[model samples]
Target: MLAVKLPSKETIKVVEEPIPIPAKGEVLIKMKASALCRSDLHRYHGKVLFDETEEEANITPGHEPCGVVEKLGEGVTKVKKGDRVAIYLGLGCGICPDCLRGDVMLCKDFQCIGFQKNGAHADYMTIPEENCLLLPEKMDFITGALSTDVGGTLYTACKRLNLNGTQTAVIIGCGPMGSGGILMAKGFGAKVIAIDLDNKRLELAKELGADYLINPKEEDVLVKIKGITHNTGCDGAIVTAGGSTPLNIALNAIKKRGSVALIAESNKAQIDPSNQFIRTLNTLMGCWYFNRSDWEEIANFIVNHNIQLNKISSDTFSISEAEKAFPLFDSGKTQKVVFTWD
Candidate 1:
């Protein structure tokens, strides 16, 4: 089998490796589709997020993986051979209360697959049977891979915001996650306004059915959003870009009593509690991964609405082309990039 390994900053190498064997209560998956996430960029630069004692970078970097089960180890009964599945990124202690509830990411001892362990970007990998979600028959590998993070996170946010046709929403980022949010907001009938600094992404947002597009670099975001809402304000906003500016924009642009979901992670921000939040009764939430139950709903929605998951990913490379794929994704010239194999 062949796999990708990042040994240093901005470097990717493909190496030959033996296929992994499943352990008790685990299943061996033959890789099919795996998408590159923005977080993976941190790994590319040799910044280790999970392990501190390790001297060299060794983990394969892909968390969004969809593949087919090839072998089932002892105690694995949830799925069988030949089953198509999407691997949940979180790996929590099985006995923990949060793990029992299927919110593995909440476990105090949880480990992210691509961060803490050898992940996809390999020809074969092993995971506990419990972490695999059965993919719908009609869903392709690309959509299956995306549903875990891109679709799941946005769907969870939409649920939190109570998005509907009667409301107007703003999405502050035109990356893959933001684009996915636009599709979800539109599917739920909300009028979506997408904001970004990049024109290419803004154009993609427009094509994805965003009612309006705003480039903050070119115009005052507050003025544009207010004008679009007829001097009122949006019913809700989602900030997917990591920064204080996007956070500030989301805070001031929504209508009174409206909600804002911050899906991005950032350390610095400016906010006025007395005026921008308290006076307006604004509801701001920090959203992370979705609940286990959200998977089925998200997949069904994608199928029923004919949401084109493939549109979010602009390019796909075989396992041998892993080196070429990373640089393209790193350049920010593409939305979602993936690796696939027969």
Candidate 2:
């Protein structure tokens, strides 16, 4: 088997290794699809996104992944061989209240799959049988891989912001996550306002489902959003960019009682809470990954709405081409870059 490795900053290598065997209560998966993400870039650049003390850099860097089960470990009964599933990124102590409730990311001992363990950037991987999310029969491997990270996160954000047919959602930073936000918001019937400095990304956002596009470099983003809402602020905004400016724009572009979901990973940011949040009573939430319990609903929502999750991921590479995949994704030249088996 071959897997992706980020030995150092901006470096990616594919190395040959023996296929892993499943442990008790786990399942071995034959990799089919895995998607790259911005967070993966953070790790590829030699940054630790989570607590992995034992040389975390060597772990295979892929969390958005899906595949068919090849072998079931002892005590595993939830999934069987040949089951198509998307692996959840969070691994927590099952006894914890948060873990039992399916919010594995919130557990005190939470461990991210790609950051803390060997994830699905390889031809095969192993995971707990319970971590497998069954996919709809019609969904493709690429879309299934995406549904775990980009799709689920953005859809959860849309719901957190209370987006609906009557609301306008301003998605800052038109990358893969924002692109997913466009599709998810559209699924909820919300009018989407796509904001980004890159015109190409903005164009792609529009092609996805954005009702309006605003390039912050060309004009004032808050001004355009307000104007689009007819002097009223948008109903809500979701910021996928880590920059302070976009986060600030998201704070100011929404109505007084409006909500904002920050999905980006940032160490710090500058903001005006007194007026933009405190006085305005804005609802700001830091959303990470979706709850495991929500997987079925999220998958069903995608199928029921006919949301094209694949549109967000514009490129795919085989395991051997991981060297090329990371650089393209890091350059912001592509949306979700993925690895596929077949």
Candidate 3:
């Protein structure tokens, strides 16, 4: 079997590896589609922030993977062979309280698939049966792969904010996650303002139903958002791009008591609680992966509203072309790049 490996910075190597057999409580997935995410870029650059050792660099870099179950191990009853499923990124101790409740990402012993173990940027990968969610038959492989991460994460964030028709939301960044945020927010009936420096992504958001689009470089983001909200500020904001500027803009653009969800992977923000936080009584939170209920809701919403996940997809490549795929994705010139197998 051929698999993807990142042995050094800005490089993807396609290597021959033995096809993994399913272990007890696990199943072997025949790779179908594996979407590239911003998180994977960390591994592409040889940075493994999640684990203790540099040895974690050896893991294949892809977390948004979905495929058909090729084989099931003993004790694996959650899914059977030939079932199409999307692999949940987190692997956790099943008995833990968080795991039992389906918030496996919060488990103390959590291991992220792409960072801590071999992932789906390959011919085949094996994961615990409990981590495989059944993909809807109406969903294609590309959409199913994205539903596990970009769509799932944003959908979870929108759920937390309780966004609705009477409110307005400003989504910063307009990358895949930010774009997904726009879709989910609109699906929930909120008037969405899509913000990004990238015109292509902003255009995609417009087609996805964002009521307003702002490029911070072209127009003052705060001014435009305030004007759109009639100086009261938006009801909510989501920052999907890292940078103190976007986060601060989100904090300043929402109305009093408004909620801001931070999903970006940045820790360098300098915020003053006394001035920016306490006065408005605004709620700010860092959000990540979704719980099982949130995933189910996202799936239902996509089916019900006829959300087109592939609208954000840029291109597809085969496992053998991963060498070309990673650098293209790394360039920031494309969106939702994925690897597909026949």
| Best-performing candidate as measured by TM-score | 2
What is the TM-score of each predicted model, taking all chains together?
Answer: 0.97, 0.98, 0.97
In Å, residue 326's CA in model 3 sits off its true spot by 0.8
- After superposition on all C-alphas, the RMSD of every candidate to the true structure, in Å, is 1.4, 1.1, 1.2
Question: Which consecutive 10 residues in model 2 have the weakest lDDT in total?
Answer: 48-57
Cα shift from native, residue 147, model 3 (Å): 0.3
TM-score of 1: 0.97
Query: Model 3: per-residue lDDT, tens digit, 1-342?
Result: 998888888777899999999989899999899999888888788776677256777877789999999998989877888999888999888798998998999999988988888888988999988788888779988888988898898888998888999999999998888888888898889999999998988888899999999998899988898899999999899999898889999999999999999999996988878767899899998898888656667787887877788778888999899878888988888878999888
Between the candidate structures 1 and 2, which one is better when assessed by lDDT? Answer: 2
Kindly give the stretch of ten consecutive residues in candidate 3 with the minimal lDDT sum: 46-55
lDDT of 2 by residue, 76-170 (tens): 98888999999999999999899999999999998888888899899999998989999999999999999989999998999888899999989
Q: After superposition, how far is residue 246 of candidate 1 from its true place, in Å?
A: 0.5
lDDT of the structure predicted as candidate 2: 0.90
TM-score-better candidate, 2 vs 3: 2
Models ranked on TM-score: 2, 3, 1
* Clash count per candidate: 1, 0, 0
Error of 2 at 63 (Å): 0.5
lDDT of each: 0.89, 0.90, 0.87
Q: Give the clashing residue pairs of candidate 2, or none.
A: none
